[model samples]
Target: MTAAGMRARGNVRTLVLAGALVTVTAALGMVGCTLFQSEQVSKGQKLYAHYCMHCHGEHGQQNEGYNWGQMPDPRPKDLSNKGEMSTFKDEEIFGTISRDMKDTTPEVGDKIGDDEFAVPTMPTFKYTLSEEEIWSIVAYVRTLHGMKLTYNVEARKKELQDQLQTAQQKADQAKQALEAADKKAEDEAEKKGVEVDEAATAKEQEANVAAIKELEAGKTAFANFTARPKLAAVPRPDLTMAETEAAKLAETGKRLYGNKYGCNACHRVGEAGGLVGPALDRAGFRLNGTWVYRWIKYPQSMKPETRMPNLGISDQDAKAITMYLATLRAPKPEKPIEKAAH
Candidate 1:
């Protein structure tokens, strides 16, 4: 072969190899992006259900149960509105969702109040979620609005960690300042030949303690939020009932108690339940079936300001639940010991 021909063939081979490498890299990049997006959207859907759907509606239509009566005045924004969502940038949506009342610059000597209201106008997820998680929610929101936005999962995670660290630093500084102020107040009272207001001092100390506790709780909650621990499956409660017509109904009530009614979420029956409501350790001894039935059916009729929501319990379900509850009786008290007369 001629030298010129050999050189030409070598040049063509080099170009072909480079082209293949480029193609493979581009394909791999595309695959990675697709996978990342899919995972984020899935996370976003779960987060939305857990957080946003209560106010925004299931499908973002603002037609949910809460939107009608439970939500505050100037009801939650209609996220389903394509035109309205179109105006805001992705960052703007994120800011709106995560911004808290205390994000503003505090005046000199003003403490950052960490206590969130029982029911906020628009609750901030900054305390609950990291930046990555919030962006995942944003990505999901985009899907609802019929748009595809790119999300960088790793970069957002780093940003979120940095933000959390900054918040911790601020909390630490606030706590230290409060401690110093409390000590200074005590010292000043001692130096001054005046009576110290014990009540006011005690109240101030209580506030400082609460602030410290809240900060610690916030850190623990955020850690748990990031961990995303798997929830344990609930075991069926073994309920005992007397041999009566109501007892027959209690069987169905037992299932309803554990599953649909979500009574177990608040009321503790045994080892497994929340502490939101009074434990039914011996509810039967305290009240009769008739009263229990009325309370279950129309709780508001009895106490207007009850924390328990009117679940619109059907007559049969309420009766069944009442029967089941009536079976619960407190243990008999033991006799007290007599003291010897001196």
Candidate 2:
């Protein structure tokens, strides 16, 4: 009950508090690391079946029925080649799934346009799946080969850069051809001794020069126009494999077509992505969910004559995708085109 007794009690309480803090820290760490390996493996299976299995077969050996094998000379690689699967790290595989060869959104002409916009080349699923889902796919891939394959991303990047250079070269050739044609026309005008409007001709020459310069700019974007446009995105947490999961899958599937899976890459759902394929703005007016699921799973199998490539989706992914496609209703009547100002 004196000063020394009070000081001794305070010291004991400090030690108790420190011990509890240490205990809590260790528990939190264990939870963070627990079963991480298996979780990653499960995620990989989902990604593989959804994105790789069609060509790789059920077990990832390899097959030809899927579009990957349907080439004039199908060369689907054997993923079991520990060397091949090991070639990519988790991050690299995720990068590949994010974009297509050219990173261009596919487009086909519209009913309203004199012609349709070009659809993106490869379907972009970047928006459909989360960063975690995508990253998990990479982690799962790492488990395959056992021998950790370091993805030579620098080399792949260089290859992409080379493709870009090749595209630029083609554009340069096109500009040269345009200039040659323009020169020929100007020469003809001079031949006729027509009093040329020097000012207008100068203006045209400058405009041509500017346009040729703009071709160097890789892709055009309307970033300034669509800032924070409230696009619908699929919320997770309800994705557990449960009864309500089916309804949630349908909601997620529809979101993918609109904002995630990049189905809008080719198929325009009226107000959705560019016209790379037939407008599905009203797919419901034409087909059913069974057909959509079957097509999403194996498009070429059903329509061997069609050019629509397989998305390499899994049963669950297909379900989610089909659910969204089912939402496609016929487009409203086309609006009247506005005339240009005189």
Candidate 3:
């Protein structure tokens, strides 16, 4: 071949090589993105199972094996329903998950029986989970409705910073209000030529100081917050057991019921716990193990308006708690001596 022809061929080869490199790089980048998304979804699934599955169900439908018809007016929504879930934006869902949905005060006419207000049963997760964890959960929830995960970390961080600023401003305003109130009280007392109630003033001051401390602590927590991606380990409860295995499981349940889950907060076993719920001292005699297990797993399924929130108890944990509760039976009655003599 001529020298000019050979040069042209070499040029073509160079262009082809550059094209291949670009294609390969693009493919690798796509793969990396897919892997990252998969990891995020996996982390979310673990979190959902641990914290949300009890009420939201395994697939975001309501929990199984209960008469949902008997549930309260606004039962847990069908999260897996695409038509419903699609209407919600990612940020809106994230907000709902992070904040409490209950309405503390309702319109006077809207109030239900006895001073009770009908409100959503969903609880706040902001205290229990970090911002990143909540975003991950949002991503996972989207998957249930066949939606893609779309998260903007930088935008979210900016939003959080703005919120912190607003909170700081509110705290300053509250302090100013408290100070003004104190000064006004002192001036009025002086003008009236009467001494202010020292004890009442001291108590009010102490409460205000405590409130300020709490606000400061909350601000500190917000300022120092950072998102770190990590997968949580999901607990698997043991369910297969024989009658002989009851004692061992019961012991485990005792610890979980009394300490881990803080069941005693609302339930009374003997002389302890609050009066918010019924006493459980004779639960063994009154309740069945299977019934107890289901109740602990998801209480809303049985009684939609029950104050008990699902603690995401695993099957094993529920079983163990059931065994422990079963041990709280009343003592067997004694037979009469006259019947034995006859």
Q: Among these predicted structures, which one has the highest TM-score?
A: 3
Candidate 1: segments with Cα more than 4 A from true spot: 65-69, 102-119, 150-153, 158-342
Clash pairs, candidate 1, are: none
Q: What C-alpha lDDT values do all the predictions have?
A: 0.62, 0.52, 0.65
Whole-model lDDT, candidate 3? 0.65
Question: What are the runs in model 3 whose C-alpha is more than 4 Å off?
Answer: 63-71, 100-102, 108-119, 153-342
Displacement of the residue 197 alpha carbon in candidate 1, Å: 44
**Residues 104-171, candidate 3, lDDT per residue (tens digit)?**
33351223455332234455455456677778788898998899767675466676677667666666
RMSD of each: 18.4, 21.7, 16.4
TM-score of 1: 0.43
The list of candidate 2 runs beyond 4 A from truth reads 1-31, 64-68, 71-76, 101-123, 147-342
lDDT of 2 by residue, 124-186 (tens): 344344444555555555655454324433354455556557656766766675566667667
Worst 10 residues of 1 by lDDT: 101-110
- What TM-score against the true fold does each predicted structure earn? 0.43, 0.32, 0.45
Candidates ranked by TM-score: 3, 1, 2
lDDT of 1 by residue, 1-342 (tens): 999999999999999999999999999999998998989889988988766665565777764524233332434667767888887788777776665422121242124445422122354555345566777888888888787665455665565567567667766766776667667777778899666556545655666676667666666545644653222322233334457776788776776665445565446565444344577767778877666776776565566545454454567677788878877885743642222121
Worst 10 residues of 3 by lDDT: 333-342
